[model samples]
Target chain A: GPKVLQIPSHQIIDMGQMVTLNCDPVSNHLYFYWYKQILGQQMEFLVNFYNGKVMEKSKLFKDQFSVERPDGSYFTLKIQPTALEDSAVYFCASSWGGASAETLYFGSGTRLTVL
Target chain B: QQQVRQSPQSLTVWEGETAILNCSYENSAFDYFPWYQQFPGEGPALLIAIRSVSDKKEDGRFTIFFNKREKKLSLHITDSQPGDSATYFCAASGQGTGSKLSFGKGAKLTVSP
Candidate 1:
């Protein structure tokens, strides 16, 4: 099975600081997505990106959150001046086509802790 | 409000028995349903999926029974094993929704040997 790799499996940052989570999606995947999951809760859709543009985003994607895949490198999620509620496990997923096309491959996840 | 709902927050079944997980959705526009399995410390993995046009889908021991009119579905796992203990998430997506999936809170299953 193809795999998506997420860097820094665990991160602890102070509130109001900027934090970036990186994901290495499958080499041939075209669509990338970010999802957040609080402890003992459902995974919530945050945002999806395609061809250097945001295709869609949920309300959970706050104004402070941004995503980019510069120069075909790692896909990154950056949160500036983070809030305590931002602490959660972030999972990155990738697919060959859009949501209706194929199954998504998800990374192990990056656990962000805000203090 | 949660668009996707799953019943039995936790379930316990004996090995070799059948385990049924129920799910219902509030959105009639959702045409795609996918069930995911997640173990501790790991990301969710796609177990099986079905489209609105189909009433049932089977893969190995896993089967999904879909009722389009009722907007309900269930995942049936036959011959349950201890290794199958994990959380299952039911997700739905509407057409041209840009691949954004609305997921249920999940049902944790424990298969005892």
Candidate 2:
């Protein structure tokens, strides 16, 4: 079965430091997304990427957050000067094209802890 | 605005009973609805999904009842087992390319023996 893979299962970083979360989407997938789930909170959409460009983004995707797929590279979420509120489980997912078009494959997730 | 909303933050059902989770969305453009199940320490996995064209979809012991007019949907798990206990989230996606799913707050279900 096709699978999405994320790196660094868990990370603990200090406030004001930078962190990069990486995701390797399914080989043939054309759309990638990032979601954040804080403890005891709903999973929030952050951003979506397609064709090596950001297609759409949500308010939660702050100025500090950035996503990129460099040369068919892994989709990545980078946060500069991480805040305490940034602590959450970050999930990376990929879909064939559209949600109604195909199912999405999600990675195990990268748990970020800001201390 | 929260596109999707779920009722009863949590639910408790006896083993062998049926568990129903409710969800509603305000966006008419949302044509895709999917239910996801999550256990502790793991990302949510797709349990089932339904398109707007269908009113009912079933697989195994899980079923989805969708009301297009009312903009509501429900997930029913039959013969609920203790192992079926987990957090379930109903999500809706807007029109177009991976447009970022809007998820409900989630329902924590517990099936007791």
DockQ in order: 0.78, 0.66
- Residue by residue across B51-101, what tens digits does model 1's lDDT show? 989999999999999999999999999999999999999999877655778
User: After superposing the true interface residues, what Cα RMSD does each candidate give?
Assistant: 1.1, 1.6
The number of the candidate with the highest DockQ is 1
DockQ, Cα level, model 1? 0.78
Which of the numbered candidates is closest to the native, going by highest TM-score? Answer: 1
Listed per model, the TM-scores of chain A against the true chain A are 0.98, 0.96
- Highest lDDT: give the candidate number: 1
The C-alpha stretches of model 2 lying farther than 4 A from their native spots are B96-98
lDDT of each residue in B1-113, candidate 2, tens digit only: 87899987899999999999999998888899999998988788899999999999999999999999999999999999999999999999857534678889999999999
> What's every prediction's RMSD, in angstroms?
0.9, 1.4
Report residue B59 deviation for candidate 2 (angstroms): 0.5
What's the TM for model 2? 0.96
lDDT of each: 0.94, 0.91
**TM-score, every prediction:** 0.98, 0.96
Candidate 1 chain B weakest lDDT stretch, 10 residues: B93-102
